[model samples]
Target: MPGPVPAPPAAGPREVLALAVPALGALVVEPLFLLTDTAIVGALGTESLAGLGVASAVLSTLVGLFVVLAYGTTASVARRLGAGELRRALAVGVDGCWLALGTGLVVAVVGALATPTVVAAFGVADGVAAEARTYLAVSMAGVPAMLLVLAATGVLRGLQDTRTPLVVAAVGFTWNAVLSLVLVHGPGPLPALGIAGSAWGTVVAQSTMALWLVVLVVRGARRHDAPLRPHGAGVLAAARGGVPLLLRTVTLRGALLATVAVAATTGAPSLAAHQVVFTCWTFGAFALDALAIAAQALTGRSLGAGDAEGTRATTRLMVRWGVGGGAVLGGLVAAASPVLPWLFSDSADVRAGITAGLLVVGATAPLAGYVFVLDGVLIGAGDGAYLARAGVLALLAYAPLLAVVPLAGLRGTVGLVLLWVAFAGGYMAARAVTLGLRARSDGWLVLGAG
Candidate 1:
C-alpha cells in the first residue's frame, strides 16, 4: 500500500513570480505572433486584413480546442510529481504528446479539406473570402506542429519548469517575425507570396518550435530515465482526460466566435475595431494568465503532496496577485487606449470603436483577473468536469445578450462597444461567479484522485 503523501513547501509570492513571470513571457509570445501578423497583413489592404481576421478566428478556435494538451498534462503530471512519482509524471507528458500529435493531424486534414466551406461561413466579400481561404488552407498545415508545441510546453510546465518554454517561445516568435517580414515583402530574388507568404512563415516557425520541443522532451526523458515511446493505454487515458477540457474550451471559443459574428454584422470598421480590442484584451490577459498558471502548478503540487492547507494558501496569494496585477494592467491599457488602435489601423472609425471597447475591457480587468486565476486553481485540482459544465452554463447565460446586440440595432462604434461590454463583461462575469463559487468550496480538493 502507498504511504502518506508528504507535504510540499508552502509557496509564497516569490515562488508565484518565479513560475508566473516566465509563463507570462511565453503566453505573451503567442498574441504577439497574431499582432505581428495583423500589422503586416493590414498593409496588404483592408480586404486582405479582413481575410486574415477571418482566417485567424478559425485557426484560434481549432487550436483553442486542443488547449487540453497543455492544461490536462500539466495537472496530471504535476499531481504525480507532487506525489514523488517523477517517472509517472514524465510518462503522463509523453502520452499527452502522442495524443496531441494524433488529434492535431486529424484537425489539420479536416480543416484543410474544408477550408473554403469554413471561410465561406463568415460571409466575407469574394476578394476577402479568397484571401481567407488561401491563408486558412496554408495555416492548417501547421496545426500539427502547433499542437505539438502546446503539448511539449505543457510537459515542461508540469515538470515545474517554465523558463525553457519561454526561451523556446522567444526564439520561435523572433523567427516568425523575421521570416514573415522577408516572405511577405519578398526581398531581392524572392517573390512576394502575399497572404500565403505570411501563412507559410507561421508554418515554418511552428515546425521549428515543435521540433525543438521534441528534442527537449526526449533529452529530459533520457536524463530522468522516463520512457519516450507512446504507450497505447496511457495515450488513451491522456486523450480521455482531455475530453472535459475540450468541451470547456469549445464553449469558450464558441462564445468568442459568436461575438465576432455579431461584430461582423455591425460592419467592417466595427469588425476591425473588435479585432484590435480583442487582441489587446488577449494581450492584457497574459499577466492574469501568468498568475493562473502559477496557481495551477502550485495548487497541483500541493494537492499531490496532500498539503491541503498549502493549496489554500497558494490560492489566496495568487488571487491577491491576480487582482492587483489586473488593476495595474488595466490602468496601462486605459492610458494607451488612445494610441494603441493607431498601431493596428488608420481608419478613424476603427480607431474610435477600439477606444470605446478598450475602456470597457480596462474597467473589467479585475473581474477577468479573478476569473482566470480561479480557472487555473480548479484546473490544477483536476476539476475538469465541473469546469466543463460551468462553461456551458456561462455560455448559455451570455448567448441571449450577444444575440440581442444585432437585433437591437446597435451598430458602428456603439454596437462595437456594446458587443464587448456584453461579451467580456457579461460572459466573464458569469464565469467569475461560477469559478468563484467553486473555489470557495471544498468540492475541488480531490488531489491525486484525478
Candidate 2:
C-alpha cells in the first residue's frame, strides 16, 4: 500500500565535489598532525619513535572506535536537515557533543589508570614500554578534548560545512608543531621534555580545537534556536544511535591493531617500517574517506528529502569518484615510495621494508576506495546495523591471513610487504565483497515518511 517511488533527483559531479573537496582537505589535515608528530618524534632516536608507534596505535584505536561520534552525528543531523528540521538537527548535534564529553571523560580516567598495563600489552622492549607509558599518560589528559573535536567535526560535516574544520585543523597542527619543537628541545627557559613534549603538544592542540569548536557550536545554536544544554532523552538517543557504528568501528580498529601486532612479531625494524607505511595508508585513506563523507552527507540528505532514487544515484557517483581518486593516490604513493620512508627514518632496514610495503598499498588502493565509499553510503542511509554485521564478518575473513604471516617465516622487507598485502589487499577485498553485495540490494534504501 505504498505509493510509487518518486523519480530520483538530478545530482552531478559538481554536487559531489562540493561536499568532497573540502572534506578531503579536512580529513587529510587530521592525519598530518600525527605525521608531524611522527617526524618530530623520530629525531629523538628509533626507540623513542618506536615507543611513539606503540602509544599512537593505542590512541588511534581509541579514537577510531569513538569515530562513531562523527559518523552517527553526520548521518542523523543531515537527515534531519534534509527533512527541514533545522532546530532538531542542531539539537541532535548538541546531544552528540554531550555524549562525546561523557564518553571522553570515562575514557580519559580509564586510559590514565591503565596506561602502564596497556603499553605493556604491546610486548615491546622495556625502554619502549617506558616511553610509551609516558606518552600514553600525557595523551590521556587530552582524551576529552579529542572526543569533543570528533563530535563537533561530525556536527559541522552534517551541516555541510567542511571548510571550517579544515581551517581549525590547520591552525591546531601548526600550534602543535611549534609547541612540540620548542618543548622537546628546550629552545627557551622551558626545560627539555623529549618524547613527553609531543604528548603535551598534542594535548594543547586538542584542547584549543575543542574550545574553538565549542564556541562555533554555541554561536550556531543561538542562530538556529537550538538548545545548547543536554537533554537526557536526546543524549540517550544519540548514544543508542551510535551503537551499531561503535561495533563497526571496533571491528575495523581491531583489524588494524591486529595488523600492528603481527608487524610487531616481525621485529622492531619491521614494526617501525609498518608505522611509516601505515601512516601513508592512513593519509591516503582520508582521500577515499572524503568521497565517503560526501556519500554520507548526500545520501542522508537525499533520503531525508524523501528521494530514494537520488540516494541511489548519489551512491553510484561516489563509488566512481572513490575508485578514481584512489587510483591517483595509489600512483602517487608508488612514485613517492623511494623517498617517503627516508623522511621518517634513516635506517636501511626500515626504509627497505617501507619501500616494499608502499607498493602493496599502492596496488590495493582501488579496493580500499571501493570499501571506504560503500561504507559511507551505507552509513548515510542509516544502515549501521548491517555495517556492524558486515564488519565483523570481514574481520573474521581477514584474521586467518594475519595469523598465517608469522608462521610463514616471512621477515624483513618480504615479511613487511606480505603483511601489508594481507591487510591492505586481503582485508580490504573482504570488506569490498560484503559492502558491494549490500549496495546492490534494495533492502537498505528505506526512508521513513517525511
Candidate 3:
C-alpha cells in the first residue's frame, strides 16, 4: 500500500524543544517530593531521617522494576510510530497508564503488608521502628500514583512530546509541595500529620498528574494524530522492549543497594552523611540523564521518520547539551560546597563528609554526562542488551571494590561510584562502536532519520 504508509514526520528543533521542556520540568519537580518527605520527617527527628534513608534504599529494588516499564514503553511506541502506526502509539500510552496503576496497586499492598518486616530489616533503633513503619505505609499508598505518572510520561516520550509530560510533572510537584506543607504542619486549624502528611501530599499530587495525562490522551491531541487507549498489546510491547533493559536496571540498582549496604557497615552517621549527599547526587544525575532522555526521544522519532541523518545530528547536539549541563552543575556544587550541606546537617563530621563527597561527585560530571547520553542513544535504538551486560560487569567490580576499599570514609566511597560511572560510559561507547562495525550500515553513522 502507499509505500508502507509514509514515514513519520521529521523532527525539527521546535519538536525537540517541545519535548525537552516537559521532560525537564517533570524531572525537576519529581525530586521535590523526596525533599518534602525529608524536611517533614527531619522536624520529627534525625532517627526518622535515617529510617527514611534505609527504607527508601530497600524499596529501590522494586522501584527499579517499575522504572524499567516506563523507560521501555517509549522505545516500543516510538518504533511503532516510525513504522507508520499511529494507532499502535496510542495503545502504548493507554496501556502504560494501566500498567502504572496495576504496578502501583501491587506495590501498595505489598508495602503495607511488609512494612513492619522491612523496617525491622533495616535495623533502625527500636524506638524509631514504629515511625519508620508509619512513613513506609503511608508512602506506599502513593506508589500507584507514582507508577501511573511515570507510565504517562513514558507515553509522552514515545510521542516525542516530552514538554507535555514535564508540565504535568511540574503541576504534580506543586500539588505535592502545597499538600505536604498543609498536611505536615497543619496550617491554621489543620492538625500536623508529620510524615503521614508528606505521604498524602505525594499521593494526591501524583494522582493529579496521572489524571491530567489521562485527560490529555483521551482528548486525542497527539502531534501525530494517534488515538490513545491502554491495552494488553501496549503492555506486552513495553515488556518486550523493557525486558533487556531490566537486566541493566537490576544490575545498576543492585550496585546502589550494595553501596548503601557498604555505607551502613561503616556507621550510622556515615550512612546518614552518604544518604544526604545521595539526594544531591540524584539531582545532578537526573539533570545529566535529562540529556539522555532528549537523545532517546529525538533518536526514536528520527528512526520513526526514517531519517537516519536526523538521528545522528540529534545525538551530537544532545551530547553537547549533556556535557554543558554537567559542567554547569558540577561548577555550582564546587562553588557552593560550604552552604549546600547546611540544609542537610550541621555536624562537622557530616558536613566534612558531604563536602568531600560532593566535590568528588562534581568532578565526575563530564564523564557522567557522556555515560548518560550514550545510555539514551542505546535505549532509543533498542540496544539494551549491551548496556545490561555492562551493568553486570560494573556491579561485579563494585562488590569487590567495596570489599577492598575502606569505604569508611565518605570521599573514598563517593569517588568509587564516580569511577563506576566513568567505567560505565566507556563500556557503552565500546558497545556503540561494535554495533556500528557489525551493522556496517549508514544507519549506524550518517543515515536518514528512521
Candidate 4:
C-alpha cells in the first residue's frame, strides 16, 4: 500500500538550517535546566554546589550512557521513512519508546539502590557526600522520563520535525526554572528543601516532558496505523541494535568520569569550579551538536534513499558549518569568561579556578565542532560499530593526558586548567583525528532503504 520512494533532495544550507536551528533551540534549552539548578544550588554555599557537581557527574554518566536510545532510534526511523515506509518508521519509533521504558526502569532501581556506594567512590567530603546522596536518590525518579523524552525526540527528528521538540523543551525549561526557584528558596507557603528541592523540580519537569512527548508520538502512530501494543521481538531487536552505541557511550562517559575524578583531587574550590566550567563546556558542546543532530537526520535520510553522493556533499558542507559555529561559540565563551564565574560562586578561589578552565574551553571549541559533526554523520549512517571502536581509541589517546594532572601533583587553578586541557583540548583533538579519518573513507557510505 505504500507509495514509491521519492528521490532525496539536495543537501544545502537552507536544508541544514531548517533542521539545525530548531534542534539547536531544543538542545540549548535542555541544558538550561542544569544551569538553573547549578545557580540555585550554588546559593546554598560551596559544599552544596560541590555535592551537586559530584551527583551530576554520576547521573550524567548513567543517563549519557543510554543516549543510544535517541541516536539509534533516529537512524532507524529515518531509514524507514526514506525507504517510503511511513508506518514502519512510526513502528520503529514505538519500539524504541518501549525499549527506553524497560531500560530506564531497571537503571532507576539499580541506580537508586547503589547511590550511597557510588557516591562514596568519589571520596568527597562528608557534607558534599550527604548532599550528593540526597540529590541522586530523588533524581532517580526522573530517569524513565528523561529516557522517554530522548526516544520521543528521536522519533520527531526522524520525521524531519524539530520544531515540536523545541517548543516542548522551552515549556519544560520554564517550568523547571520557576519550580526550582520556589522550592529551593521556599517562597510563599512552601518549605525550603535546599538541594533536594532542585532534584524534585527537575523530576517534575522531566515527567511532564515525557508525558507530552509520548502523547504526540502515540497520536502520530495511530494516524499511521502503527501498532500501539509492545512487540517483544521488536523491543529486543531495538535493544540489540543499541549495543554498539551503548559501548560508544561508555567510552565517552569513561572519559568524563575520569576527568571528574581527577578534579575531585584538586580540592573543593577546584572541584566546584570544574563543575561550573564543565557545565558551560557541555552547554557549548551541545550547541555545536546542533549541526550534528541535523547531520544525523539528513545523513540517515540520504543513505536510506540511496543518495551516497548527496550524503558525501552534505557532510562536507556541514563540517565547514560546524567549524564556523565552534569558532563563534568559543569567542562568546571567552568573552564571558571574565563575568561567568560570578554567576555560580562568590569565593575568590573557585572564581579563579573557573576562569582558568574557561580559557581552555574557548581555545578548543573548533576541534569539538569538527568532531561532533562527523560523529553525528556516522551515527546517521548507522556506522555504530566503527564509532564504538574509534571511541575506545580516542579514550586510550586521552588516558595519558588525564593521568598527568594528578600524577604530576598539579593543584589549585593550575590543576583545574590542565584538567580542561586534557578534556577540551587533548581529548577533542584525538576525536577529531579518528572521526576525520572515518569521514574521508567511503566505507560509511552505505546505500539502502535500511
Arrange candidates by TM-score, highest first: which order?
Answer: 1, 2, 4, 3
Candidate 1 residues 358-439, lDDT tens each?
9899999988988899999998888999999999999999999898878997889999988998987999999998999999
- Please report the TM-score between candidate 4 and the true structure: 0.86
By TM-score, who's the top model here? 1
Query: What TM-score, computed on C-alpha atoms, does each candidate reach?
Result: 0.88, 0.87, 0.80, 0.86
- Enumerate clash totals for all models, in the order shown: 0, 0, 18, 0
- Candidate closer to the true structure by TM-score (higher is better), 2 or 4: 2
Number of clashing pairs, model 4? 0
For model 2, the stretches where C-alpha displacement exceeds 4 angstroms are 1-10, 38-51, 123-131, 185-187, 190-197, 263-276, 334-356, 403-419, 448-450
Among these predictions, the greatest lDDT belongs to 4
- State model 2's lDDT: 0.86
Each prediction's RMSD over C-alphas, in Å, is 3.8, 4.7, 5.0, 3.6
Query: Candidate 4: where are CA atoms >4 Å away?
Result: 1-7, 38-54, 122-134, 178-198, 263-277, 334-359, 404-422
The Cα error of candidate 2 at residue 397, in Å, is 1.8
lDDT of 2 at 273: 96
lDDT of each: 0.87, 0.86, 0.67, 0.89
lDDT pick, better of 2 and 3: 2
The segments of candidate 3 whose C-alpha lies over 4 angstroms from its true place after superposition are 1-18, 41-62, 184-194, 221-230, 263-277, 337-356, 407-450
